[model samples]
Target: LLPGDEEPEVDLGRLLQTVYERAAYDLRVRYEEEPVPPLEPPFAEWAATLLREKGYRRR
Candidate 1:
């Protein structure tokens, strides 16, 4: 969903995946000597619910 893109539909899964990947990349850069931590489940559930609500709230 970059600026000026004309697609009317959004791919929510892709969007979330992109966000996770970017976050992981940032962590790797920030902690070059430490391994990136594994994602925890509660946060994942919260993110999914939040994204779902945001994506469908207008309907």
Candidate 2:
């Protein structure tokens, strides 16, 4: 409903959910296959903490 007239409708919750799912899926795939140098012991724990904070609790 800006310049051109069309429909007056929007679903913000659905949009946010779609974006979140896409981002989470991409992150999972990229991290699972990528190789990297050894990290300090704390790095693994940090990753777990971040994931949990994002509501990605591992199964």
By lDDT, the best candidate is 2
| 1-59: candidate 1 lDDT, tens digit per residue | 79999989889999988987978854544322322464378865565566557662222
Off by over 4 Å in 1: 1-7, 25-59
**TM-scores for the candidates:** 0.30, 0.34
lDDT of 2: 0.65
lDDT of 2 by residue, 1-59 (tens): 58888886779999887987978865664443222664576886676667667766551
Off by over 4 Å in 2: 1-24, 27-39
Model 2 weakest 10-residue run by lDDT: 29-38
